[model samples]
Target: MRARNQLLDTDEPGRTVLTRHLPLPALHPVDYARGHAQFEARSDQRRRIVGWLDARLAEHPAEAPLSVLSVGCGTGAVDAPLAAAAAGRAVPGAVVRWTGIDPHGPSAAAFDAAVRHAAPDAEVVARACTFEALDTSDRFDVVTFVHSLYYVPDVLAALRRAVAMLSPGGRLLVLHAPLGALNELAATLAPETDGHPQWWSDTVIAELAGMGLRVHVEELDAEVDLTGCDSADRALLDFTVQAELTDEARPAVLEALRAAARPGGGLRLPHPVTAFTVRPR
Candidate 1:
């Protein structure tokens, strides 16, 4: 308890409390960052995204600078790696214009901090706004919604915006979790306010297809680490469910998490993420 309290109290400037409890939003960006750091699988996601980026960059002629926009760019964990890759030999003589957006102010600040260090050479801009309010006339060569479409008010509209904001021959990459066991637990424990099933890969795909966009999908396996996790630790559960929960609801949630544990039957979750790639000409 002391340790947890200590962590929450030390918020830097520009820090604010998390008010939205839709698809697993923490009350504090710092708390979200803590939970995010616990997931080793995100490292895998980062590697996969960076590898795909390098491949895409290779295909380009280096005719113009590469522009990348990251929607819901949290704390810069995923973008920093991609920025580093963009700065590498993938596209010689091509600069990477990095633009990131997140409604959370602190997360945006953290993103700017991370990007400054990771890809200092890249032209980076971090904004505290959602894609809907991006207010940008610039088009991007690559726009990514890495694990961020869940909380949007309208998933379909966001997808359309992502597609519309793309430069000619640009690609839109979306990494989202499917309807997995962990989400089922969350759905049972804390139903979303959206009055619909959470937006999984299928939801996004259906929307994209309706818009006549060509899309391809890839399955990526991951796990939500509840190792040494305390259900009493509200931040972890908040991130897991992407929402706020009552103390009364914690036990059932914790039990469900424990059931998915490994050989020891501890608190481990089997989380599979799907990657959606769309290239619109």
Candidate 2:
């Protein structure tokens, strides 16, 4: 039987996202951690999100507790930071209940441990399920999709679901890499494995705008360091492109990636991140 709300690709109506295949290594925690570390050094959007949330919470002084639903939240990297920030804001008896959903069980468990370590006072919940499979009646004051939109079967449908999950005046935050060096390199290195559509930052912005929602975009500048990385790291980087390049392609790929790096720095690829804050009209 067909799922009631399955996300079907427009171009391939018969092909749903459920049957879509993805690169296994791309989801590896080690790769994700390494990539996230590089971006963390360059930008502080996590803190920025905290400040944004603090201001929003200030607007509703009566709302003592804020519910945050994080889709594709992994390892408490971003969510835990936000929780720690929320704890410090100390919104006079502010209780933040954060529920993070990720399909990876190990990552979800790690997230639980990390949140406990980072924000012990903050209430945290982790669910091992994909956002498409998540079943929850509870809505949230804030919904976030941080670097996880690409995996969604249908971007537009997922955005609509995010809208439905929000309370009145609630906000949705999306952080993703646009058509920058990483994506470009991915295309050049492994064109055959680019299964996901090129729905970059602009595509998302336009989609949100078409829905009559208010959207704010902030670009984060960063670089992915390839210097001193071992072979395993290189494999992970190849996995990101969803293609395992051959020994022949490796040299050229490395050359291009390194050439794009900042002068005097490691093979730093320009990774421009975009943050979108969306709200219903």
| TM-score leader | 1
C-alpha-based local distance difference test score of model 1? 0.70
For candidate 2, list the clashing residue pairs, or say none. Answer: none
TM-score of each: 0.80, 0.77
Q: Please give the lDDT score at residue 72 for candidate 1.
A: 91
lDDT of each: 0.70, 0.67
Model number with the top lDDT = 1
lDDT of 1 at 65: 84
lDDT tens readout by residue for model 1, 1-281: 00111211235454322222223322455766665665544235556655665675556555568888989998898788777767764455677788989988988998998987988788999999977788989999888888889768788888888888899999888888776667665444344534544567778878887887778888876555576656245566666765555565555456556655656555656677787889874
* Alpha-carbon deviation at 202 in model 2, angstroms: 2.0
